[model samples]
Target: MKLLPLARQAEVTNGWLRERLRAVLPEVMRRARVDLWLVVAREYNEDPVLPSLLPAPMMGARRRTMLVFHAPEGGAFEALAIANAGVGLDGFYTPMWDKTMLAEAAEDQWACLRRVVAERNPKRIGVNVSAEIAFADGLSKSEHDALMAALGPELAARCVSAEEVVVGWLSRRLEGEIEAADGINALAHGLIAEAFSPRVVHPGVTTAVEVAWWLRERARSLGLGCWFQPSVSIQRRGEHLGDLGSSPDAVIRRGDLLHCDFGLHYLGLATDTQQNAYVRRLGESGPPAGMVAALAKAKWQQELLAAEMVIGRSGNEVLRAARAAMARAGLEGRIYTHPIGYHGHGAGPMIGRYDNQEGLPGAGELRLQDATLFSFEMFVEHALPEWDGQRIKLATEQCVAFRGGEVHFLGGRQTAWHLI
Candidate 1:
């Protein structure tokens, strides 16, 4: 039931990924009300929707997986791909749609695609073309040119953006995908634990830079992929510091507050986690009182943030509600949660980002739905009356879902600092 890595054939059930994607594609086609659905791609080049529609670790169209769905929905969804790599979409998909053999249009794959379109003659064709959310921008320039040449005079006018349906399909989760996403999201938290423990630090000597590297190496060796580099920092007594873009080299002195923000991508899902750590003052069995309360406040903020999860609320609505709830609790913080599914930060409803609280006009305006995964990236910045006059900072992140109108964490959040 878990969505395992594509290469691990035995670990995953076959056709599961495709089944989920196909089940939703129609909704996309239906919503757009387009006459024909055309997806174009080649080996190395794939349409924005390719991975979801593909047969995993998709090498490319040995037989491509291009597909077209004519309006009126019946019969199998038409598809095309390279010959024999076993796209296995036979009936559902056909081999190359060649109007001319290798002799004509030798350098392009679009020649064959035109044949599929010419036959269907869709009035408003949906292409992966888009103005935002770059993943949906899958078509290549050369392929665009060839498609234009083959379609002739009016083809340009026929195309329109598939952004809405594409975002809905890609960002929205199926029942089965949640099972896979939850199973692997644990890896992200595990990486955080390892980086913060005594095993990776020497207190007075080890620096955040060392822990960051450990995260990268650990993820690589374990076969867990990272969307971006991991970040580790010693919040050693600070007040106002912005996004710590890189791992700081400051020595990890005893009594310093340290933490890491990291995650790994595996199978077809991703996990995001951020945890705080305390470089124990020698012989002090626990974190300083201020640090303990700060971590506690961060956890509470997450709890309050989760309270906003309700079906049918748009990303902006949920975000506004979560922030208000935090403020009501007398908590000081920020939330930058994003939909996490097929991609690291998949295309569902975004809870919040750093600067864009009002939200982008499109994706951010999308509504929240159950059975979808999200990175509950929020923070608590309060004056820890217990720390030195310099003050301190605390932040923690965990993955969760708004399942059936309630928000639940994948594994759980770090309520206390990693004791090293």
Candidate 2:
């Protein structure tokens, strides 16, 4: 695959940021009942939303960077950057502070922030603070104290947590971003295919760890990175491999069933995928029918989960519906799907968890929205007759997007085992 030049990539990223700010930010603020949004962060301790808001070339937050977004009752919002003049936010944000301006004024940046807030006198000012979502809880104690001090007691009273706004902004994917993510997901699938093939795995000679590192190295070679370390594990006939150990020395042998959990992070989007592989034994022409049947159950569970992702339903509600459907179909499985985009385990509602499959308390209450992407992650446990009635866990996670009330698998899902 051809890669974009650094300059071109920056241009694309800036364009996406501009579009998202224009389209998503205002609507989210309005829905969340916020008239003003303040995003402040130090240099290295950047907020999660900062990367999405910043211009592409500017990798991290600058010294004491403060972004103030003001949306009035009926007009277009204003984006103001209270930081240095030339950090590549010229078109998107109006510069509110510079070194020369600071030198002229006896007051500091906080004073300028106060002036901006006092001018607007917004009824509701949104800040990053929440107990439920970590991505929305970016404000540090010191930063919070400084903000309260700058705004004074009365104005600070209007401050509200921006959890809803931040969640909406981060989870909604623009058209261009969705297209870019499609390419990234396709590349990830191709890399996984290569890793499972004979080119990288030499049967008994290669180890699971070797294949895992090969996948990581392959991603690096393509100028990409993995959000989590890639994992490859074996599930033999009688041996129940608990925890799927990450040891790099577990050798790959014939007749062993292989599973991989991998994800790639590139161009501001992340993908989480899990695929299986089967090695051919000396006399066997293909995997046993019972093993194939077990995989079919996993696919069926995926379908059941996808069918429950209605537009306005909460994640917990969806979980209940999916479980009911699975019960009707006589299938037993666990669903732990989550949104994936800016972060690997991205913002929005969490369907279920590996440990807590009943329902997540606060996070699961978040309703599903359109134009959001998710990792359709789940597993099915069933007895395989070929393996002496031993039950196996067949887990699968594929990147999918929900738009126009339809769920589309980004770059398609893996239905058949990747034969080695």
Candidate 3:
């Protein structure tokens, strides 16, 4: 599927974003304990926070642009870079680039960065580099080696981790970005509902693979992207994550359960949703007695998982709470949720993986930030004694945001599945 368009590039005014940056910059500096932040990258290499740092007009990274931000003990921050425009840092930065000097100084990126560091003169320097988060691994290995050699041992020793600052910025959602994300999520429901209709899925005709490709093609037709590969499966009687039977070789039969785990990407935002559908027979009124009960119990488990989202709490806290709630309710389920944003699987506050829920160092350590977006992802399986006697697994995903100390669903949660 094709990726959806980015938001229209608009004029940034002296508004909340500017004010928030002013407040956040100093706070980040103090927390990170770094007087200066030197973001060094050649063309095509950018800081994980580069999009947030740059002004609207610059699309791709410019050559040898080193953004420098410093907060002195007595005054406002000093914002400048090796370019004419200072990444909206003009309020606190002094432009230090001259066309004549850059043309004659050297063709080397490392040499230029060293000169700027010597001129700026700050105690501590912070660069984005981390072992846990791939987003922070923007610095190329060769570039890192060159930087250390050119800056000398003393200056190189000043580098510190920018993980906390990166997490704080990425997890904290902006107003415009939230609105766009919400709209994109709502569009996902429409795409799936239409794809599951009889027009695309004819009983005894279309295979699961055919229906899956149709979903991807339909999304491409609507000018959007899929977060991962779209998956479609039919759970007849007995199915498991390990084995879902002989891969839908048989035709779609009456009273069969059609389950799908899919989502679409719109406006640069990715969504994850899973849903179930039942095929009606010649005189059957609705889904079989057993499948409905199993789905109901699964839905109950969904509620238990969603109710635990809290603000200012670590991923580990919410995760433990969800498990406790699940045990109290006597539901068998698994939770594997992650942060979703500008990049899919974005970059903060990971709840728990299906396999590893005991806790992770950097992953589970991040606390929930208000206004942050997350995909409420998990699964529930229940056994039915009423029908032919089998277990059915139900999974659904919806976008939820932590705002004002509470979690609110973006559009709405699916209570019942759409019948095919």
Most accurate candidate by lDDT: 2
Model 3 / residue 383 / CA error / Å: 0.9
Global fold similarity of model 3 (TM-score): 0.84
lDDT of 1: 0.69
- Prediction 2 TM-score vs. true: 0.97
Write one digit per residue (lDDT tens) for candidate 2, span 1-420. 677877888888888899988888898888888999999999989998898898878888877889999877797798898886676677889878755524554457899899888998999999999999898899999999999999999899999999998999999999888888888888889888999999998887998888999998988888888999999888878665545535347678888888898999877889999888888888887888887998899899988988999998999999999999999999888899999998999999999988887889778999999999999998888887887887778888899988888888898778888888
lDDT of 1 by residue, 269-298 (tens): 678777887777768999767777787888
The whole-model lDDT of each prediction reads: 0.69, 0.87, 0.69
Model 2 per-residue lDDT at 77: 90
Q: What is the descending TM-score order?
A: 2, 1, 3
lDDT of 3: 0.69
What are the models' TM-scores? 0.86, 0.97, 0.84
lDDT score at residue 138, model 2, on the 0-100 scale: 97
Deviation (Å) of 81 in candidate 3: 3.7
Q: Which window of ten consecutive residues has the lowest lDDT sum in model 2? A: 98-107
Candidate 2 clashes: the total is 0
Q: Considering lDDT, which of the candidate structures 1 and 2 is the better prediction for this target?
A: 2
Give the root-mean-square deviation of each candidate in angstroms. 3.7, 1.5, 4.1
